[model samples]
Target: MSPSVSVTCTSLSFAWPDGVPVLTGLDVAFGPGRTGLVGVNGTGKSTLLRLIAGELAPGDGVVRVTGQVGYLPQNVTLDTALRVDQALGIAAQRAALHAIEAGDASEGHFETVGDDWDVEERALATLGELGLGHVGLDRTVGEVSGGESVLLRLAALLLRRPDVLLLDEPTNNLDLYARRRLYAAVTAWPGVLVVVSHDRELLELVDRIADLRSGGITWYGGGFSAYQEALAVEQDAAERMVRVAGADLRRQQRELADAQVKLARRKRYGQKMWENKREPKIVMGARKRAAQESSGKHRILHEEKLAEARERLDEAVEAVRDDDEIRVELPYTAVPPGRGVLTLRDLELAHGARLTGGLDLRGPERVALIGRNGAGKTTLLRTVAGQLAPVSGEATAHVPLRFLPQRLDVLDDELSVVENVARFAPGATGNRIRARLARFLFRGARADRKAGTLSGGERFRAALAALMLAEPAPQLLLLDEPTNNLDMASVRRLTTALESYEGALVVAGHDLPFLRSIGITRWLLMSEGELTETTWEAVADPA
Candidate 1:
């Protein structure tokens, strides 16, 4: 964080072309410090970052910044033909320097060189810092791994020396080693750094957390853990207020009832007196008028009290967040304890990565596939799912299997969520599928939404539902980076859904916290064309 850089949004607003509002009149300021911008999916975290980065225009209001800004979007796309120096934005400078060294210096070359005579050195240093030391300046972008391409983009940003840097889910496709390198960069950032991510480890490196929700930002000092603690305290107090307000509402209702009964009794007594002619006509008329006025006043007073009580109750309820959890039974996916799940015999994948020897998985074991970017975890999973033929050896599944790829392409974009689930479970009736989808948090109209219209979180839930609720009830499940790009709440919902799965599961991901939460039974390391058994402690501290 630097004191010279600042970012502020004044009366900011934006909406999609479909007229669905995302952010409206959002006013927030980011001072000199690393800020982790977080919220559930569809809360406009990425949209706000885009607004700040000038990638998207604000429909209303203004965005102000005091210095140059660089943004690393969630999806990093670089032309395969681009050279490393070109990707880092230093190719022109390097060429000018080389021309000068060759005694061919022109005024144009001098102008391009300017005062940054050590641009190449700085570029190499930044690349090395991001664990791209082996990547040569002249190498093509396609020569590097996907994770390396992400780091290359970040290096380009760092070379610009911008005062404000924005990153949206920077760790989405990165492996554990690459993520560590990214974490180092974030820790050492000197200017204003705003990152939108669900990576708990990355969030923990921030100076503060700005939670975007309900079209506004709630600032919390410290990292993600502190933010969670503060939020817990706030929610506890809100629940207490709700209880108190409910009690007051009930009390007001009872008092209103009692007042009405008393007024009725008085009216009855007056009527009886009038019938018996117990008082003079003039006095009786005066008494009747006074009784009517008192009754009206009393009735109005009680109604006002009841209204105030109801309003207070509504406010109290609003303070409590309604984050629903997925609660579905997946008994059909259950595998027998003694069942043979999968087997591999000296498996060699199409990509030239091979297992050292044979491997066997039994029962309802949950395996965590840990590897670097190009280690063939996905290829192995695909082979197990029978999507690919192994170049050598064999891979076999003893039970029904399903693979949820990283891209989540199992869904049909043209169909509604209910229709998609129905496609997977063709044997189930429409009513049965809808009832099961309700457990995935898609109830009523939500189930009717076209899959193409779903947000990232919603799409993940829909895809998961379609798979988990399939007719054959896959007894063996393989997931490749299932948590990538998912917000924390959606990740939790995924975990909840898996809790009831009762099947043999194999997940390939770098999210250690999530893997631990889902109770991974075994850890397998894929490195250098070999698979070896490992432990949680070993993976966490790979010294």
Candidate 2:
């Protein structure tokens, strides 16, 4: 199959049943080589990919796909009935059949029989590229970690040699090493690629950047680093324009006011002179007409000036404000820690029938729960949160804690922002509830907006608000992949907030910069429920 593909969308639009248009009149084109799709959390980046993959049809407009395409969604539930090797073999067979159907028989294939040897060679090469060459042929798919399963899918896609590869948030749960390896492999890939990811490092490796926002795609003809620089420049220009425009509007308003005041004063003086009856009739009449004309002209000019000022102000406001993201302020309250906040002795987790291992964590110290996908980091968190009991061991926590799971499932999606906040802060009045919500950027009518309507970032902000609004703040905060769908700006803001937090934090995050920025002092790596003490290194300058 040809390595290059072209995709184009014209006047495309789509919306849910309630008529909330996710994409509107969007037009975008993708060519060969790697491309990064970027946008805020709820701007429909993933929706666009689905549209391209033909998983969802556009409500309006046309999407033209010029070649065979393979897509990997942000998340998938792999069939567990098949063994790892069985799944891989099934994928390979499919790829071979697909290639034969496409009439590509260069690498393997008899004159006409059996699985194409050429296709088999290509499939094995692709698997090797994904670091899955040693995957035992008999291993079950259900036995592999999430990351391993995803890598398997990726390998399958490559083997298929589709003209285009669409990957949506492919590294959401991948560790630093795994993510880096994936990046390297993708950068070296020889086909058209469109990836939706918030990993700036991965974006840096792409050939072009496409930013989807407000139902449109703005194509930046450079890599992620260049895109960042360009965005900075754009923001600076917009800010300057806003300042200049505001000044001009103020000056115009002042000038118009002064002109009107002078005209009114002149008219008053003329009237007084006429009232004395010393002036001739002609003089009085002329003076009155002159005053009337001047007043009319002044009123017209004032209106014109006001209108001009409003136009300039609106332009400046749009330029300055529309590009910026809403900032969130997470509240921090001091909490007294118990004698021992967390204590665990000889705890273990199992994968399949084997006793994977044991963990012993005892301390007043801040612990970091770390592990690869399927290594039981989340499982360990659940156990610590008391949501799940340990298989066999003693685990204890003395203080009232707050556990923010990987998914913000505790939030009431059906409630409004104010309602959600009020649920936890029953003593707070409506005004106070709104005030607290505003701190998280749910100001004005947004406080009344349903939580279900909120984007991922907004949902996270709401979650943060509810936690902080509680009278007795949580002394322990357990976060799992807290930065999952958050943009870089929000991530930085949250990191700053967490830095000042007085409570003990047990966070599991795969974002390298984020983890480092928040200052992870200790590392407790979890593997199959077994915790191991690993040296935490600065990924930025890991010499």
Candidate 3:
């Protein structure tokens, strides 16, 4: 590794107790720059981050860090009793500075202060940058929303000023405004920053991309788009190689057949000549032996050549990913254009949000629910899905519905994926449920694994499968932050699954690209206790 590399992993290997290997013999070096770590779910992006952060020890090899490392994990849970200053790691310093300013200064206070005399000020400034200005240093973590807690955790890491920063899915719960703030922070990072995220905008801020797959990493210069372009080129080349290898194998097979036929003809003609006494017996026997030897050599040579060509083709095929997509058919989910899917008549949610004019979804309209943090987007979706009753007025779903919440709480932890789906679809037989689960990438015994053992992306998929495969065949599909914490491939699979859904869709999420990809026909922004109509462009540029 270069001396300039801030983080290096040599011959790293790790495996679960169940013998499922994640990273094996992996060696990589991260220098002073922003690198986006991207890959499909279960590819160990998060696991690698954890190993680099020393949170999880590698089963083999070593990790070397030239300087301090600060890691922001995907799931941030701050203690409710923790104060903002303590969370930012400035509470002691702030107290020391105050103590020295008020009266007789103790040497201990000076030592604690160190060089950070304005620690509190800096902490507040960091909070403000992450749109947490209202959160006072004395405020407890319980007072903030889930999104704010994530930002607060990030703020704590940023305040550390480490030489290497590792952020795993840092923008999972952040709103659009917070995401922009994070993007700005990433753009201005001055250390060796490696961020594992599926957020397209965040990935675009990276200086390079590291695609982790099959226990190896491929480095691509520039941002996510550049990585995609490079991958496409690689796939194209691999495909061409496969084609060439196949052609060679066919040619070898044909040559082998021709040689065998010619050897047979020679044997017959030589035998006839010997029988008619056309040539000496000794000469004919010698010629016959030579012909057999030559035929055997030719056959062996062609067979080996074909086998080698096939091996090359197999290697080429392995180089290109399967890219098998999630295929689902929901013909029963279709709703006629004139049919009413959902209607909220002057609805007032239990949380006290009031909708005066109400809201309605007709036919297969795809609605994108956009709003800032604490805007009641999730509450509205839950109300429409009948998870919560309206405080006043009427909220009705004209069709069978299902809600896949952001937290994916619908799944029972103890139940296996197949059993979970069975819970939602009691009418469907075990074989039928398993067959559908296979489409969601849970083939064979994978479907029998407990939901608690699943990774973040797998959990999301299982939850989605349960809702989509429900017995009633939901026609009003409600999704809240569907892309939250999902890897890029999982997001693609989600989009693919949604494409096959013929029902009315209402998705509340911060992922604009995902919403657009799902063909959101209408945009609704909730603010100040009301949901109002909006456009994609307007939402993108809310000037």
Candidates' C-alpha lDDT: 0.94, 0.75, 0.89
**True-vs-predicted CA distance for residue 35, candidate 1, Å:** 0.1
Worst 10 residues of 1 by lDDT: 1-10
lDDT (Cα, tens digit) per residue for candidate 2, span 1-543? 363368899999999889978999998898888899998777888999999999999999999999888999999668987865455555455455566678987555333336455554565676677766777545677767677788887876776667889999998878765686688778887878999988878888899999887677778867888998888788799888888888988888888889878987988888788888778989899879977987898789888988888898888777653433334343444444444566666665333211234343233345666666767777767777888876676667655677777678778889998888888788879997887667567889988888898877778878877776665666667888988878665675576567556667788867765776777767766655456677776334434
Sort the predicted structures by TM-score, highest score first. 1, 3, 2
TM-score leader: 1
C-alpha RMSD by candidate, in order? 1.5, 4.7, 2.6
Q: Model 2, which residues run further than 4 Å from truth? A: 1-5, 82-116, 136-140, 273-287, 321-332, 335-340, 349-367, 426-431, 538-543
Off by over 4 Å in 3: 1-5, 270-281, 411-455
The TM-scores of all predictions, comma-separated, are: 0.97, 0.85, 0.93
Worst 10 residues of 2 by lDDT: 352-361
Residue pairs with colliding backbones in model 1 are none
Model 1, 463-531: lDDT tens per residue?
A: 999998988999999999999989988998999889999999999999999999999999999999888
